[model samples]
Target: MTLNKDHIGGLIFLTIAVVYGYFAHDIRMFPGDQFEPFNAQTLPIALAWAGGLISLVMLATAGRSAEPKPTLVNLDFMLVGKLMVLVWLFAQALSWIGFLAATILFLLVGYWLLGERRIRTLLLASIPFAVGFWLLLAKVLDIYLAPGKLWQLVLGA
Candidate 1:
């Protein structure tokens, strides 16, 4: 059978879903939290299942599609690679810098990598969004996020 965009997309989606599910299964739970209706691992595991199901359905129904085969000639693979590296760095930064600082740096650098150069525009775009998201996760959701290793060492937080 000839592969089309749908088939490729489905395969990629399936791979991501499976990987996500695998990690979700490893999530640690607090004592007695497993018996609760929802816990730390609940949403991730549920999303993984949903993603897997959707991807499987996508693959099953991807027998044929009108969409043209994706072209690689114009693809900016260097940018993609940079973005991937950025993501890795962000993960590393999370442990060292803490959630808020790491997030702020990630968003700012991500915007810059995507070609946003204006100083005001970059700050305007990244800062508020990062702060707001941090607030949402820490305040609204009451999720405890560490401030960062830098802050702890410098400010003795």
Candidate 2:
């Protein structure tokens, strides 16, 4: 009846791993003979096992630590709430705007939300990170990322 934070957290983690592991296992990663020696399934299986191990560690540590019982305060709800909302916004924006522009907007907004006040820091960091990621994905990886209409016009595309 009385579930401690450790028990609850471990339960949540275990549940996630079980659900994810099921889906990961269900995917037919590669054909039989043609499969690479280390196929896609290996990574998912490793992740599932690692997640389980981490959950076990969390359970053990929570039980042994003398720290006071966990409460809502221990979870840092405000920061978590902001992070979740930011992720949601980023996902929605990613489709309409290209990856680079959306990501740059995301970084600026996230920095502002996190109470970063320096304009120089925001501009300097956002520009390079956004441009570098785009260059790496587009040029180095031989991948094409969607450039929003605005960017196309700006870059003469």
Candidate 3:
């Protein structure tokens, strides 16, 4: 059996799932949350198990694939590095510019990095999606999101 992309991906996914499951047990809960049916670790552990199962299925079905293994010489390492930087910048921007603003910037920069140059497309794609997701997390889920240092300084909110 050759080690194709599917094999490598399945192996990586399985390894990460196992590691995540191992760490999920360490998630802390509230004083009385331990006795509940679902707690801090429940969803994580469930996702780990589901990922592990899916990875196993992928591994099993990967053996019969007809495609030959391709070399990685054509891989876009520079794009990957840029994306990594973008994610790091987004994390840093979250505290400085707030979730909605940071998310819009992240999507805009990501789309630009992927060779999209149209400003209208960038704004249309990023703004509405970021605002929708922000509303979902903030309004629908009732999660507490910081207004960011810049917003707080400017608006005093």
Candidate 4:
């Protein structure tokens, strides 16, 4: 039997699902919490089973039809490398620049890298997203966010 892309993808997804299910099943519940309605492992195990079932359906349907094979294209390594670097820089800047500023900058740079040339649109989209996320996590949720080293230095806070 010839292995098609769908078959290969299904096998890979199946493997991942099995691994996820195994880990999820092995998660230890707290003492006297065995009868609880929900636990940490519940959702993960359910998702793993769902993924496994979907994978089985995919594998079973593979090569059943005479569909044309899709053409493959060469990957752009330079673009991939740039995205990797961008992610690394974003991680590094997260603490130093704080969540709000760093997220806005990251989104702006990401949009630019993905061929967004309009400054007004970029700012309009990114600023609100960053500010909203900050407000949601920090203000509404009462989660602590780093004030940023730069802000601390500038404001002496």
lDDT of all predictions: 0.90, 0.81, 0.94, 0.88
Ranking by lDDT: 3, 1, 4, 2
Per-model root-mean-square deviation over C-alphas: 8.8, 7.2, 7.9, 6.3
Q: Write the per-residue lDDT of candidate 4 for residues 1-157, one digit (tens) a residue.
A: 7777788888999999999999999999898666788888889999999999999998899878454454457877777788889999988888898988889999998898888999898999899999999999999999998988888989999
| 1-157: candidate 2 lDDT, tens digit per residue | 3467787788799888878888878777545823666776778877988998898888777766555556675677888799889999888777667898899999998898888989999999898999998899999998977766666667878
Please name the candidate that would achieve the greatest lDDT relative to the true structure. Answer: 3
lDDT of 1: 0.90
Off by over 4 Å in 1: 1-71
Instruction: Give one digit per residue, the lDDT tens place, for model 1 in 1-157.
Output: 7788988999999999999999998999889999999999899988999999999998898886686677789889999999999999999999889888888888889999999999999898888998999899999999999877888899887
Which residue pairs come into collision in candidate 3? none
Among all windows of ten consecutive residues in candidate 1, which has the lowest summed lDDT? 62-71
Error of 2 at 69 (Å): 3.1
Cα lDDT, model 2, residue 122:
96
Q: After superposing candidate 4, which stretches have Cα over 4 Å from the reference?
A: 1-73
Give the poorly placed runs of model 2, Cα more than 4 Å off: 1-3, 6-68, 148-157
Higher-ranked by lDDT: 1 or 3: 3
Worst 10 residues of 4 by lDDT: 65-74
